[model samples]
Target: MKRILLLAILAGGVVTNGMAQSKGNLNSLGKNDPKAKAILDGVSKKFSQLKSVVANFVLKIEGANNSVTDAKKGTVYLKGAKYKVNLDGQEIISDNKTSWTYAKDANEVTINNVDPNSSTLSPAKLFTNFYDKDYLYRLDGEITEKGKVLQNIEMTPTDKSKNVFKVIVSIDKKNQNISKMKVFEKNGNHYTYEITSFTPNTNVSDATFSFDPKKYPGVEVVDLR
Candidate 1:
């Protein structure tokens, strides 16, 4: 149970990634080769144009034996630096500064200050700002899956001490959106985040990123800030 809780927190934590300098929020740290830069530029530009985005995703955690240890389905709404994620037993809402994490099973909510530069992989970072300086990326070529052409971009973390060793991103060439992402961790644990559905230019309200305790009855709020 402790392990599961840890994983849940990690999944729900705030992660900072590099948004292109052109987008006015540059935080990337890795050196991208020409080909990688071009491909990432397309992704960066496409997402930067969105007022909001909503996507359904599946998270699979695999063990060392290549067996699935856990799997969960979730939905994410992202706008600017704000995001809200909904899973079966958990929900994370963040407005870029403040973050609220609720675990239904525990009937508890934890609030904290969101450090955008944190080196964790959050859903918000995965979709928009994943390709920046923390990863040295290379284009691994294109492949067709389900009749859609995907450009495979391989990313190696610049920080060797990090638990995550490598990340492979599959981008849809037609839309320049991320089709899937796989993270290889040093502890023999693998996480695969697959976008099952994507909706761009969504009409998400700012209130959606802020948590309302009134809506959740009989829940305890723990302020970690």
Candidate 2:
């Protein structure tokens, strides 16, 4: 269960190109340049038009001296404010109001109330809105990746005390989509999330965002709400 949550949080903390500003929050955005704002807003507008998104990702956790401590691959389903993620032998389902994390090995499911504003990765913040409040952003530079031109943007958290100190997002210039994200933590660790496949407007039922424990026989439910 702990491993599942770690993956989810690591994936969710990633920021895509978007200008979804948090309400009454302008301090962190004061350093944003006009060019950077334009680039991010363009990407956000394009993503906002999608009805749903499905993507596969590769997550890598690096320790000191840039040694990769762990690597995992996962799939994510997103529609509106809801999301479902499958990583390792665990699954995370969120209906935008509540979240369920189920571990196959332990046959246990942990449920909790959803908090979108939490520093941790919440689906609500992951899909549609991010990075206008917590971090001050700027266009670091541009580069080429896999024959595609990508704009690199760097962000620093407003609160210096946060565990995550810096975030860098690599955006696909042609489509304005996030291709990769790197998070630098204060504890000398870093996380990287690379989007391997992205499909927009994928047909999916709302029920996919909710979990049904009955389907899994002998699953123990632990409610933390």
Candidate 3:
């Protein structure tokens, strides 16, 4: 079960990018440059238009010793404050009110009612609010991955308690979608999330985020709240 939650933390954290030319060279702009602000403004505007999204991808986790665990062929659903992640046949659901982490192998589930704002794991907070302020974003050089050119941005949070020490987001310039993310935690842990497919503003059902342990009769329920 701890392995599942650890995967959630990595997926929600690590496994969690821009445009233009002449103006395209905004990558060369300094932190205080107005051109940089203009570029980031455009990116932020595009980001604001995304209300909900669904994606299919693989999350690869790497340890300090370089051991890797890959959760292949997974789906992630996101709404305002709710998210459901299914990876390698296991599921984790959170509605900004309650969270359920279910392990298929052990037939056990852990439930916790939490303040959404208190968790760095919240997708809304991770994608929207954190990007709004409290961090410095600078465009890095472009790179080609999976045959697509991506604009890389480095983010460092100003607040210490956020648990994140640094982050890098690779954004697809044409679609303005995030292609990859790498997060470095203060505890010397790091996580990386790469997106293989992304569908924005899809009609994801509310029931997808619902948790009913009774549905799994023999499953053990641990109330962590």
- Model 3 lDDT tens row, 96-130: 78888888989989899867555344453534443
> Stretches of candidate 3 above 4 Å error?
1-44, 63-72, 126-134, 159-164, 185-190
**lDDT by residue for model 1 over 1-225, one digit each (tens)?**
322322332231111134232133222643455675676677766766778889888888899888999988888888877878788788888888898889899999999997766655554454444434455666789999998898887767667897778777888889887887777888898877778889988889899999998998999999999
Model 2 stretches with alpha carbons more than 4 Å out: 1-30, 116-119, 126-130
**Candidate 2 lDDT tens digits, 150-206:** 888787777888777888888898888888888888889888888898899989899
- Find the candidate with the highest TM-score and give its number: 2
Q: TM per model?
A: 0.82, 0.87, 0.73
Candidate with more favorable, higher TM-score: 2 or 3: 2
Q: What is the lDDT of residue 103 in candidate 2?
A: 87
Position 196, candidate 1: lDDT: 88
Looking at model 2, residue 102 earns an lDDT score of 89
Q: What count of clashes does model 3 give?
A: 5
Q: Tell me model 3's lDDT, rounded to 2 decimals.
A: 0.62
Number of colliding residue pairs in model 2: 0
In candidate 3, list every pair of residues with a backbone clash: 14-193, 15-193, 17-171, 20-24, 21-24
